[model samples]
Target: MQVKIEKLDHFGRGITYVNQKICFVAKALPNEIVKIKVTKETKKYIEAEIEEWVTISSYRIPEVCPYAKICGGCDLEHLEYKKENEWKREKVKELLAKFSQIEKVEVKEIKYLSPYHYRNKVTLHGAKNRVGYYQPKSKNLVPIDTCLLLNQKINELLPKMKRLARENKVQEIMIRTSNDEKESLIKISGDKPKSLIDMKDITGIFFQEEQLQGKEEIISTIGKYQYYLSIESFFQVNQELTEMLYEEVLNEVKKVKPKKVLDLYCGTGTIGIYISSEAEEVIGIDSCSSSIKNANHNKKLNQVKNIQFINNKVENVIDQFQQDTDLIIVDPPRKGLDKKTLRHIIRIAPKYLIYISCDPVTLARDLKELKETYQTKIVTPFNMFPRTYHVECVSVLVHN
Candidate 1:
């Protein structure tokens, strides 16, 4: 069926009404008439895939990546980068207004990092005689020679790493390359040979089972901060741009002059410690025990106090909060905060909520919920992960 797409949904899907119900069609752009195959039928909406663009939009362009449509790694490669950012801003605005009922959110210009060669790390799976990312909407893996999103040094090393993994009879391997360039980590999982431990070209860690089980450190650095990152720990990928991103988030905190701050999903206490001096006390909570231990070690290493790192789920820690939190900084995973945590945040009702998210769709939906009792004062997106459709947005919500 031919339909005129009216707008881009949060997932970059084109939304058009059919029978008074929304239809989400992939690979269709706004103002474009496209021939679509209805892959799904549901009570409220239909899911479709674009068979052909009957009339292409002006914004449509040739995607650079060969696997653009199938890789599922990026959805906005066909659209202009500028327009993508604009759509992201609009998505945030729409969510805040529609979901949160907060009006007039001042979304700042999206800060773009290096569009290419910005990624320092990538997780490549091993199965069916090759290693690559999983295909879109399927567990089927796509064999990749190299990704343009990674640094040249990392890309240059993919083949070698793959070879090393195969040679060691490894099923899954995660390569960690850093901005330092001098050091990199190769984590081999699934019955890795001990000979890999003596490899001179790479610093290796072995895992018998899951990716995170046996691996030790994932060394990473941002600005002057050098982190002996735990294998399962969270750290920003784009090194050069992370400083800029953190500065913008800190900029929001500085303006607020928060006394007691609650840092949710505080991976290794990066943001909490970075802005520790400004706030009188900062409490950081995360589910990862390794990350919390590192956060505590980092606190001692930096000789900074007044920042408490707790190894507990945010939901559990929320109940223990002193109810005197002036600012709440929440940086959730791509899935975003669960309903229970969202409810808890509303109950706490801190003066300011500095929300950082890598997924715009979730960020928008969460902001909508927060807008019930809070006003979205500012929304700023940082291009932490460039050369791809992924974006990291920061929203500041203040109590009404």
Candidate 2:
């Protein structure tokens, strides 16, 4: 059936009405009329795939990816970068009002550095010696020769890595390059370890069988600070904006002038370490042991004395939070804070709270809970992943 696209949703799907029922059409842009085949249906809405475009929007451009609709790695690449940024910030605003009853939230303009060839990392899934991402919402593999989202260096390594992966039995291959492009790390997960690949661009080539054991440690630098990344350590996917985001954190924390600070969900202690010197003391807590290990290594590598790293679930160790800790910076995973933990943290009522979130919906939900005891101060969105629906945001809350 043919429908007129109304607007884009948070996930970049075009919203329209068919038979007076809500419909979501993939690969359909706003202000365009398109014919779609119903793919899935529910009482709330029906999902569809665009079969033909009756009228394309003026903003629509040729997609760089041939397997875009099926690969599912990127959802918003079809939309123009300007429109994507506008919609992403608006999505955050809309979710805040709908889920959290927050209105007119002042979200800063979305910051986007590069729209293409910006990603510094790529993870390819391997099955039966073929490599690519799984088909959308399915386990089926889709082979690809190139991806416009990955860094040029990663793109250059794709064909060679594919050949190497085909020769070995593996589950997933992760390739990462440092922000400076002077170093790269390739980690292949499989049933058995194999000979490492020696390429000029790659600094560390490690195989993960039962555990992560590698030759050279993966080190990266952001501004004045340097970070050590292990095979399992979590780091920001976008390198350039990481520096920008950290600069934002530094600016905000410097204003608070925290004597004692707590960095909750501090993966690899990047944020804590970045602002450690500004504060008299900094404590970083994360659930991942590998990340905490790297965080401490980073602390020692940088020879900073004011910061400490702990490997434990934040909720389990949150009671140890010092009452005098003036500021708490939280960079949690997508699920956001659990109910019990959110309540506990809010009850503590730190003088200032900084939240770093990749998922806006969860962030809005947590903000709603925090609003009762804290006043929403600042919210800024960063384009961590361009050409994708994913967006990163930093929000600050002050005690009421």
Report, for every candidate in turn, its global Cα lDDT versus the true structure.
0.77, 0.85
TM-score of each: 0.85, 0.95
- For candidate 1, lDDT tens digit of each residue in 225-265? 65666656787888678888788878888998999999999
Q: Give a tens-digit lDDT track for model 2, residues 1-400.
A: 8889999888888999988889998878999999899999998899998999999998787777888767988888777889888888888778877876665567889887888787878889988887889987898999878898888888888887788768888788988887676678788877554565656677777776333333455788988999988767789988788999999999999999999999999998999999988899999999998899889899999998999888999989887665678898999999998887787677666889999999989998899988778887878999898888889999988898
Name the top lDDT candidate: 2
RMSD of each: 3.3, 1.8
Q: What's the count of clashing pairs in each model shown?
A: 1, 0
User: Which 10-residue span in candidate 1 carries the lowest summed lDDT?
Assistant: 206-215
| TM-score of model 2 (CA atoms) | 0.95
What C-alpha lDDT, on a 0 to 100 scale, does residue 309 get in candidate 2? 84
lDDT of 2: 0.85
